[model samples]
Target: MSATDPPPKRRASIGARRNPASQAAILAAARAVLAEQGYSGFSIDAVSRRAGAGKPTIYRWWKSRAELLIEVYAAEKGALRAATTGNLAEDLTAYTAALWDFWRDTPSGRTFRALVAEAQHDETALEALRGKFLPERLQDVRALFGAAVARGEIAAAEVEMRLALYVGFNWYYVLTDRLVDGRAAIPAAMRLVAASLRD
Candidate 1:
């Protein structure tokens, strides 16, 4: 190849440079597919067709459907906050109720459920759940608990145990299709936690 000759054709890098518009299109397409087709119908193939992008393009950016789903959930869920009210029990109850409402009323619920199921079989998904998603969620819980501690409602030593209990309680309700019942149950559960902390 001579310098005078046309420079060697450069191959476009795969996902090396993410175009913001293209990425948004893919995420929007993913959300549409999840909402319309449900998790069972969700796939890179489906998203590719919907986004007018190729499988390689989607795969280039999101290695697995689970990774794509995580992005979709994060985009859709946005920031979650509960009422502070300077009361631990009220804060917990409000937070749980808000979480239940989000899960039951939006596409996020199904997307999350699918992600959880995928993690059971996919190491990538499992790592994302543990390393990324759960920590973000726990941060919110910690903030709420930290507020409670500041109010002198609970000792600092109890936050970790309460955090675990709070997460497990929410997971059990969501997984069991008990979000409806969870509304009434949330206040009672919050009161129990508050009582236990006070003891």
Candidate 2:
């Protein structure tokens, strides 16, 4: 405690301080890494280097790589609005076409595909997808179907099945990388769906 004694260095904080700039940097870096390296090569170390932040800093904010990946996917995906054409068939076709284009042309698609792949082996990611992401997405689809029911274009009872069919159809194309080729089938599919609903 002597005056001549060197002052002890302040202990480093127990965990990384939640710096907005740092977090934004990390997220931006994560997006870049995912876009460039994809999910297979994405890692804490890679993001740490890209963001100029340390591993501990990244880990302090995101518990795992899968968690970070999910965040990146969610942030990039944002909110998608369902098309509201008066005709149910037109609305469904437009909505599906927009979705296919979004997936095929944007980083969000790859990010989501990675998230789906990660969820297969990571429970945290799976929970996020099943419990959070998927539900949010389904709501948009539900709105579209709800509108059809209100218009009497489809019975209320048919909404659930249509939702499942619509989601499954889009997911199949996304996972198979068939969006471009599948575009042609959308009109036929929507016509069939609309016909069934009307019947």
Enumerate clash totals for all models, in the order shown.
0, 0
Colliding residue pairs in candidate 2:
none
Residue-pair clash count for candidate 2: 0
**Top TM-score hit:** 1
For model 2 the TM-score comes to: 0.76
Give the per-residue lDDT digits (tens) of candidate 1, residues 90-188.
Answer: 888887777787788888676676678678988998988987788876776688888888888888998888888888888887777777866788898
Model 2 lDDT per residue over 17-65, tens place: 6777777778988888877877788889888777767788778877778
Question: Candidate 2: lDDT over CA atoms?
Answer: 0.75
- Where's the lowest-lDDT run of ten residues in candidate 1? 5-14
**TM-scores, each model vs. reference:** 0.83, 0.76
Clashing pairs in 1: none
